[model samples]
Target chain A: MSGSRLSRRTFQRLAAGTALAAPFVRGAHAAGKISIGFWDHWVPGANKATTDLCNEWAAKEKVEVQIDYITSQGNKNRLTIAAEAQARAGHDIMAMPSWEPHDKAKLMEPLDDLMEPLIKANGAVNPTVEYLGKADGHWLVVPATAGSQIKGPCSRIDLLKEHAGVDIQALYPAGSPPKADAWTMDAYLKAAQACHKAGFPFGVGVGGTPDSVDTAGAIFSAFGAVLVDAKGNITVKSDTVRQALDYYKQLMAVLPPDVPAWDDASNNKWLISGKGAAIMNPPSAWAVAKRDAPKIAEQLWTHGAPIGPKGRFAPFVPYFWGVWNFGRNKSAAKSLLLHLSQASAAEKMVAASGGYDLPAFEKLTLFKTWVEEGPPKGTLYHYPNPYNHQVLSMAGAPAPPKIAVQIYTQAIMTKMAVRHFQGEAMEKTLAWAASELEGFMRT
Target chain B: MADIAVSRAGTVNGAGGRTSLHRLMQRKSTVAFLMALPLITVIVLLVVYPAIYSLHLATLNKSMERFVGFGNFTFLFGRETFWLVVKQSCIFAITAVVFKALIGFVVAHFVHNIPSKGQRKWRGMLLVPWVIPPAMSTLAWLWLFDPSYSAFNWILALFGIDPVPWTGDAYWARFSVILVNIWIGAPFFMIMYLAALKSVPEQLYEAAAIDGATWWQRIWYVTLPMMRNIIAITTLFSLIVTFANFDIVRVLTAGGPLDHTHVFATWAFRVGIEGGDIPLGASVSLFMVPILAVAAWFILRDITKRGNEA
Candidate 1:
């Protein structure tokens, strides 16, 4: 009985298991702090400055705010995929793209649970039904700050006036900015052609992606063409397709020798370096040049995307922040969403980060002088953009386009336009492209 | 004696005789299997279960909550995007493997020709591309393809040649990507082939040369014939990796300048993960199975046949 009192091995096994399991159990329940996940160092308004601000907010609230930062550097495509995986695995609260929130409805929490008052406050949510809140009838997302806008006729006003012999102030007058609204594909071709003839042969950027496609799409959509229905259906051919092709071929002849080889950040770099004039880009172009390249930045002028033939129109890409669906702390997630989405926070973060031109939230205030201060001084003030209620409504329309519009657009981009630029089927391509997209839409 | 017998009986009967299952489990193998129980449980929980679950997902509609039963597969057959993806995956896989194998073999032979000490030195330095993690290496690839700031263009400029649209044009983008894959992959084949080359008895080459074989004939008769197994194995491994290459295409072009460069994996992820068409994504991912299986079957058959012949 004395010898068999207790087995030493059994006691050792029990003690070892207890030691390992105790910490894990303790870790699950002991969290009194909140983690705010953000795109680290990738974009401004949500970087180290934002991190410091979150810390400041936490200190004021007497709570701990742990920020888990990630960089979107080379993993842009994987961002959406990773988010879905994280959601299934669980995201306490992560910031993501506007379109992503709509796609990843299942993994996020409704902001209604976070701060119900903000949504219903003065009926702001009602007026901006598709504008500010949930798209799929689920309150899974909230517009954190002002929308992100680009498609600027970001130009060297000094260069355009200097090289092309155009007046900077008059073309863009006191209140109404010229070349700001959508114009015909022909108008765009003429504008570029006129610039080229004036001795800026390699005038516009055409690395064939962001610069080329943006300009091309601006023409395509402005002509009231739809490439894909909003529901993700493919449409190939349209009249808009033909018109865009005809115009691009005309425009391509005057583009620089290395136009095909231009990189994504090239036009921005060229515009900032003062090597080129009148590159269309996002508002960040103004912001970045203002900070890094002051001379070019000072020469910077911003404009909304040029209006298309169907009246002033451009693809309006909406940007914002939202609460991920499944979070550990529900109330805290909503409160954070409300606080961050506040006009105050957006402006502060924008000022802190300093590259954004448009705040998705309407409340942000950055007038002509916002770009004139400090490093962002005189450089960003050269351009003024006015996107009003009318412009907003058109860009924000909810309905998907009809079928005929889709087909024509596809033929233009995929078959004709791309092929034309490559010198494969230059002559016959435009007519075929026009009829194809239009025919496809009708079918 | 009776008390001793009773205690001994208790030792055998106390826990073991409780049930037939318990009685059967009383052995060294049973204890060994019992120890592996947690791992087996984890394999079922994480790997086996998800595989079964993914098959279930593939048979459903968009949301995956509703059952459609092979509807997704049937739908995929008619979709143009699905066929394009299938063609793209094959071209990507077949082309990458052949190039990697050919380039690797040539490099391996060159590396083998050096003195043993020189061979050791070159092998270590040559593996720099393969040794560095792929993610780190891909950044360099991205910079090379950068539209304006391309290092490739910078070099091309030095020679007074026009810069190619390495990533802008659809064909050029595919070319740029496959070239990068070759640069990173060839060394792996080189290393494997070199090891196989060294493993070949010097006597075989000597014997072949004695048989009046020239350099090309020696290589054909001695080198390739000797290194065939290594070549086959390496190509099969590369086939799986290159076919399922998501990182290079994703980071560099993202199936864009208009979806011309998309493979099955990236397209599936776009539809499934990004687009939230989970069932569609799952179904798309299933396209990789038959190709991967065919490559696997060829490798296994060769390996087993070698064993049997030996």
Candidate 2:
């Protein structure tokens, strides 16, 4: 044997000793390590912007950071959140979809300290964010800019003007506050009817999907319809709800007959196929159209939702960055979140998302990305609610979250409308909704 | 040689009480069990443990903080949607399995009678549906049933027919989902019955022919009697799978049009995963076990009976 070679037993002993000491060695260096799971962005290069921002922060802070772009597709992000919360392990930070921060509030680290400073720097946070991201007066997560989106009327500008005689650009003009007083539910129904007669119907779905529920929620909110109040009382039997249902019945008649079966992608597909005058959606449809069919993309305009008896309401789904209480490097996680929430980083994220992402802070809403993105210039100018023309609301809000989540996920509002549209008696539909709301309250 | 003989004699004679376990381990049955240890360990860890954990989960309340002991079950029992799901799950499983078995039997007979040289190509083509992942194929089906751009509707429109609501109406949505399941599953039954067909003795058919039996009679008397076990087992398997189906319904309808098409699996997913009520989801899923267990019991008992008869 060579003099440099060790005996087999000695070699095995040394390997075993090293293996035994490895975790301790890792523990010694773990103080500066932070891992975060972000919602995988739909827009190309959006994830890279967030990654670059994180890398910049990590470099300045001398911390090692790992980032995971978790997709919300197939509920994988929610599944990851549930698994991490159950195991008390996984990433130090995770991007929580709307209602998820409330769902897992107990396991999340209260970020009042991180959020308060950001709130101070970037004006007041959106009330909808405060409603969903806070539990018992403590902020459980920082409102995220990566996946946050406002679902509004993304219309075919040419089709609306030519067929429906409603010019979207004139109503919500670029570089100015919306001249939207004439944009009411009655006008929306008239436009829908006109568009339907023109064979390019409005593609609004009343199915039990998130898009369907969100659209229904906004309409219901606009009519001041509350299925369950904040204090957990069932309110489905009110006149407001009945009025909302009646409006939906008229609206559904103008929609394609197959809308009841539509999934989340159905509306997007409907718009991109050039068969629909408008769809209630994020900029995803417009973005997809931009890539696949530029002609259709150039005509697309995202503007404010129509007004109702109470007010104009837009469906807002805000993603949040939550720190798990059991995370190893919480200090680093909080610092990284604060850094990302800053105006400069948030603006970069919104720009990268092609003006699709909406920051939760009021001050950050004026970023030029919304005004600048277009094939037809200023096509997305009204996307981020820069003029605050509409009330930003989530479906199933005002109810206690535990009940509201059921209301949202069960798609009660849409289902009730569908039941009524399918020729069920109005009273019968209201009773069914009342029963469902009761069940939600009971559970 | 003498020591070996002595050891063997001692094992057979139960000569040492301390070595009883050692002797037991040397037996053929014990050796077979040891050979199966890895698989048993795997099943115990993966299948049995998760099932038991899910059962435990079913008893807990929504938050899983308190043991509610059947509270989730009671809650599900009271909800109208839950009852609808139960009815829908049964209808989906039974109806899909029946059609799948019937179609598979007819197709298998055709394949069996075809020229042996061409059978391979036909079988491969038939098996394509089974081979492709259901998720990928279902996405294609989703496109084919797209509300605005359905290929099927386009074809119908060519013949002056109004576009059919393939997945919009509650009845049509149920039909669409069941049709997709049968399309994916019939191939599996075809291959199984094809194997069973090959094993049926040709002489038995000849014997029936000599007795002047018709083609239908031959099949009814000889072929069915022989393939009964395989049919029972395949139907049982398809029943279990169809009852617990999630992908087709989830991808197609997502239990929409007012929860008209929700099966147990999809409804459970909606309530449990999406709704963030894991305990209730577990309870919903646990309801599947009794129906599946009853099916398995009847099918297995018949198989066992036929085994004993043989």
Candidate 3:
């Protein structure tokens, strides 16, 4: 062999070394590419906060980042998630809604390593987030600060005092712990009836939409009504369930006759139009009111939910950021998620959302943004459960996720209340719910 | 000599046939097939393939792992909500298509009677509903029927009438969705019927008048027979579209107010897409096929019979 040409043995060794190094070379080249799909925030300018943070991280890391803000309107984001999961292709990091992290856990890259240190820094993760974000004892996603919300009562201060005679401010004063002992479900019902007679109904929906489902879930949780227990057993025939249904029947009577048909947007429209005294929602309604109806916005107060016989349960839905196992740039995706999960980044996100986004971490909930945001100063102080007086919950919880997701999506609880409200006997309604629960378990 | 001549003719005929067969690419049928290749490919990829895939999906479990044959179907059959969807879907399609046909027939006749110069203007104006996308138009209708800030309720209140729960009550919600469908679809029917009306020879109407037949009698006897085929074909087409509708019901009620307003399409979407049960959703959607197929078969049969008679 010529000196310029390698001997056969040497050539074979060189070829094997090059082949071994090829993956690292490819990794170096591909490390720059990362894409993410975040939930499009309802609050104006919220998307900019997320974009700026991602860009800042991208510049520091010298990685190319592409971000797409997917909307929940018409379930487009959900459809996108389903499409990507089936195709095993899409953005490296995609936002998963409350139930979705559980639904698509098998396809997700395990994130226990990323989540553990963050949990240490940020404080304990809420049970709702832990329940939904973990699967088979592994963290499937990083809790996202965008699109998480607490569906607490946002009431018209003037209307509640004038008609309902409920001093909501005293019960949940700004910059103080909630004195909500007197704010029971019975008092809530009386206020609803009073507001209805005054021609401005409470605007609580009993329809099969997220807003209605969330509200119903909170109410049921407060009453200790578990239609399906955690063990995957049917418990719709319990007394607590009946008590919750009875309460809903009365509450529905005082609400608008069309509450049964209301969608998630209806309550926002109701509160913003000055047609409702209160609605169980996040601060988005108030944010819109501040823009379009300043007077209504000024009168709005975000407060804790009413205490039930069992306890105070606030409806909380958290969004999660999950990296796909099939992603080409998993390392970059994980790094960006970790950066976003830091306290400063999460605080900026919460502020940008106008206090509408609730961080899932216990320590992060005390961000001053929630304390200072308002036409009425400290209007949102109670919005984040500052004193931790209430138990944060996701509707259809405690039951195994498989059955719980079906219950939530099908709006079974709301439908049951509506059925009984529309004149079905309580026993019949319970029977119907039991039958539906049975079917859910079977599926 | 005669036998030899016959043999040579036969050979010539056979050779000519073989030459034609060899030049298949130049044949008219082959050219037509080539021209239609793109459309055929699209249909197979977009429609036929997804449809077959959905059938296969329906047989699998929720995870899309193990096959469960007819378990999804049997499960659906036992649910009350499934029965409710079946009932609502049938009612929605039949009622909306019937009303649309009646309104379209009347409006088209009225437009047909207008002066020829003005007919174009009226036709153009009437098609505005059909021209707007259903999703956009339904949004407008949703605002009009909104529970709190309804424009219609505002106007109704001016007359001392109470607000109508357009989509609040189960009955009203069903009525409201069907009404919107009729509003958007009646225009297409009007255009179709108008075209069919123009094709009906004026001589027949003139001949019926000479025989002392009244306007009503002429329409019943002459016009009905002339337009039967067009009406049948248009109705079948509308039936298929109406039965498979997703936008109107989804936007308006979303199978809400205790699932009283759920049709198969919306229910399938709730189960399949939002509910994360792909197999169940596939099963729910597959139910539409049999109803649509039977409708198509009956309408096509009637049209064929009418053609034979003609």
Model 3 / residue B188 / CA error / Å: 1.4
> lDDT of each structure?
0.60, 0.91, 0.90
Give me the runs in candidate 2 sitting further than 4 Å from their true place.
A1-31, B1-31
- Give residue A386's error in model 1 in angstroms: 4.1
Between prediction 1 and prediction 3, the one with superior TM-score is 3
For model 3, state the Cα shift of residue A89 in Å: 1.6
lDDT of 1 by residue, B145-246 (tens): 776567988899999998877777778878877777887888999999988988999999889888899999988888888887888888888998898888
Which 10 consecutive positions of candidate 3 chain A have the poorest summed lDDT?
A23-32
Q: Against the true structure, whose DockQ is highest? A: 3
So what's the TM-score on candidate 2?
0.93
Candidate 3 error regions (>4 Å)? A1-30, B1-22
Label model 1 with its docking quality class. incorrect
Give the TM-score between model 1's chain B and the true chain B: 0.84
Give candidate 2's iRMS in Å, 1 decimal: 1.4
lDDT of 1 by residue, A28-115 (tens): 2253567665655435554665666666665555555777665545435346435454446444666664345544556566665543
Tell me the tens digit of each residue's lDDT in model 3 across A1-443.
Answer: 58788789998999999999976664323557899999998887999999999989987777889999999998999999999999999999999988888888789999999999999999888788888999889999998989988999999999999998998989999888889899999999999999999988998988888999999999999999999898999989999999999999989989988888888888999999898999999998999999999999999999998999999999998899999999989999999999999999999999898898878888887788887888988889898887888899878988988889999999999999989998999999999988988888754
Q: Sorted by DockQ, highest first, which candidate order results?
A: 3, 2, 1
